[model samples]
Target: MKLLIVTPHFYPENFKVNDMAFELQKRGHDVSVMTAIPDYPEGRFYKGYGIFKKRRESINGVKVHRSLIIPRHSGSSFWLAMNYLSYTFFASLKSLWFGIAKKYDAIIVHEPSPILVGIPAVIIKKLQKIPVHFWVLDLWPESLTAAGGITNKNIIYPFEKLTKWIYDNCTTLMIGSKGYEKSICNKGDFKDKIEFFPNWVEDSLESQKMIDVPKLPKGFNVVIAGNMGDAQDLPHIMETARMLKGSNIRFNFIGDGRKREYVENYARENGLMNNIFCLGRYPLEAMPAFFAQADILFMALKDTPIFALTVPSRLQAYMSSGKPVVAMINGEGADTIREADCGWSVPAGDSEQLANLLKHLSTLNKDELTQKGANGKEYSRKYYDFTKCINHLEKIIGTGL
Candidate 1:
């Protein structure tokens, strides 16, 4: 199968779509990616990427075409809007031209957010009369209201319409969470087209050599990896840390995002520095090493209906690391921890419950904690296997052998 993946992010930006495109290419399919200049959590173009620099490159065997986009400087609402709109405008134009020059059997839109990425795939689909598979990793309008804090319907209505149009035009909708089905169906009659296509643990994470990180403080370490953003509910995590102060538990944050500075300041100002350690972001390959030193893997999301439906990608990574999980999250993510019997979960933003759970977990012996970790590893293998997921994707895109 000849496939083209249209996404707002790609390699050098650290998204799951990178793994999907590479895996498809590895499976005897010709896969190419259309993306923007690498700028993400840092909110600035990567050191060597820009409009005129390295616009076209190849990674492994997959061809990559990058479109010019405004960097999300400071990740403020204004800058983020510019970043999203720039990609939609430039990628759409690129799609029209690229669609004419290149032939592809199907176009996969790797939509993590700003459903507008589908505009380009929809354009190419119209030009070539081919299938457009939209992998919906985040819900629109709801994310704006939930995470972005945009409440005015007058402002959100347009995005809601755009979201529906994108959903209506796509040949297939691959939802990252089953909880999203109801939301997509509410937008339109997409019931027949919707498929549950959850994120898988990266194969690299499964086999990592432990590398030394900043010496962790002596105690039961709770490693919180991934983006520290509004959606992550960092405020409550800090509150939990404060409540657990003077205990053996320590919260180690291992990622950077919009709220990273705020988290750092909160820890310092409140004198919670001893209980919290902001280890900062590290390369993806180095995460398992950090996980190796953790007594528990912590994850959380703000208590919003939209977030409740989200099964954060980090959850799969943590479970795959063969570590006990502790989540201050609701809905799907919380349910997964319970179903796997991997660890404990508390309501999102509930510092009291979270602190209490950590206290109890600290009391558990090494063997008991290891059992929970083992349960998660087994469950991840059974349900979130990467090979099985890619196989399902092949069938969805009509490329199944």
Candidate 2:
């Protein structure tokens, strides 16, 4: 099988696309990625990446084609638009000029963002008559408003239409959460073909090396990994840490995002710096051991209806680490944690209840924590294994593997 995985975010940016591409390549499919320069979470271009010079290279047996992009986004909504539009626009041109020319049995557009990333896939689908599956990670229009990226419905009208076109045109739509499925279908016409496809941790994460791992500062660590955006309500987290001032629990935040400054500043100014360790971002591979070092894994989201459907990719990572979770979110994500008996959960934005849960967790003995962690790992194995996930995805894609 020959596969073309299209995405704006890929290697060096730590998107799930990396794991999927490698899986396809490992399975004997000639997989090639069409992506722009890496600039995400951090906003600026990474080392060895540039705006102009287009390049192609082989990464771990998979061929990768890079395209030019306006690499300035991450923090502000203005730059966020530039980041999305710039990648979609140029990458579309790149597809027409180069990417679409390749012979591909199937096209898989891995859209963790910007529905427009599927533009190239649409062109390839129409021109070559190949099937293109759009794996939508986030719902547009609603997400734009949720992220405070775009609020004006008048200005968002065209984008709304665009979203409908993309949804209607794709061969199949894959959504990670039932929340996304319900919301997306309500917006337009996609109720028939949509399938549930939660993101899974790569099978490789199970083999985290035991030695020479990254060290934590001190205290019982309750770590939250992944993006630190406003959607996360990180200020609330800072306040949670503030409330737990004299406790043994230290809130450690890994990964970078727009509100990271707030996390740092609030921790420092409020005299809780030692209690809150903003360890920042690290590579995806390092996450297993890093998570294993923690006493409990943390998850939080804003008090939005859409976010209730949200489950961060890092949740899978945390589950894979076999650590008990302490979640502060609503809806499906919290339901999953509770169902798995993985850990405890309080409602989103409830600092007092959250503090109470942490206190209760602290009272639990080591053996109890270990059992909860084991349950989470077992649940992850049954549900969050990429091997099983991709098997289902390939069937839905109907590429005839």
Candidate 3:
């Protein structure tokens, strides 16, 4: 089958879907990607690429069409919206102008918001008479609501109406967690279309056997590696660090985001210098070593009403590493931790609760720790494997075809 995968984020941009696209190609599908030039949270074109009209190229065997974007939105909300809108605009135009006529079995769009690419996607689906499936990585409007950024209910009605339109139109809706399925369906439509599309990590046994990886700085290391943003209560993490200041426990933050400066300054000012270590973002490929070396992994989102439905992508990575998590969030994340018996899930934003969990984890014997980590790995292998999700994708495409 021939497929066109549309996303604003793709190769050389450190997104997981790039690997998934390659996997699709390897499965004997002719896969091509339509994307913007690599500029994400940083808003700067990558070193070799210029900002301009669309450029076409091949990476490995997959064909790619890269379009130009505004290229100036890293942290600011207004610019970030502009950045998203810019890619969506150009990618949609390019898709209509170029991709609409192409013969393909299906169109798979990646999303937090695939709305920009959706225009051409819908166009091609209409013109070519093929199915277009929107693969949702994050639930929209709800996530916006979860962040507490959108308070205007007056505007929400129109946006909600549009969201319903998109939801009903897409041939199939794919998401990462079952929790999301319920939330999306509760909107009164789209109940039947939502399906779990678990994210995957490639086999790590080879690398684990290959060499002795670098160890962490020292002591009981708990690491949080991913976006540090408004959705994630990183300030609470600093507060937790402050509470653990004199302990042997160390909290390592490895990722970049809009809130990096704020999180950094809080630690410095609060004198959490002894407990918290902020390492700037590392390349995606380099993340495994850090995960492998950590004593326990961690995830935290703000105490929001909607986050009760979010199961962060970081949890998948943490599960794959065979390490128990020290989670500081609620709802879906806590449920996962409980169901898998993989780690402890403490209340969000409570430094006292977090401090206790951290100290308790330190007291656990190696064998107990290993068992918990193994439980997480087992749960991930059974329920969150990408291969199974890809099979599910193939089935959905088959139904549509």
Compared with the true structure, all predictions reach lDDT values of 0.90, 0.81, 0.77
Badly placed stretches (over 4 Å) of model 2 are 52-54, 399-401
lDDT of 3 by residue, 102-188 (tens): 788899988865344566677667778778888877666676676637778885676666667666668888887677787678665
Better of 2 and 3 by TM-score: 2
Give all candidate RMSDs, comma-separated.
1.1, 1.9, 2.4
TM, every model: 0.98, 0.94, 0.93
Displacement of the residue 240 alpha carbon in candidate 1, Å:
1.0
Question: For residues 1-401, could you state the per-residue lDDT of candidate 1 as single tens digits?
Answer: 99999999998989989889999999899988999999888988898888789899999899999999999999999999999999999999999997799899998999888888999999899889999899999899898999899999899999999999988888899988999999999999999999989889887788767666787789999999999888889989999888987888999999999998998899889888889888888988888888898999999999999989988889988999999999999999999999999988999989998888889989988998899999999999998898999999999998786
Tens-digit lDDT track for model 2 on 333-352? 89888888988888989888
Better of 1 and 3 by TM-score: 1
Q: Which numbered prediction scores highest in lDDT against the true structure?
A: 1
Model 2 accuracy (lDDT, Cα):
0.81
lDDT of 2 at 68: 73
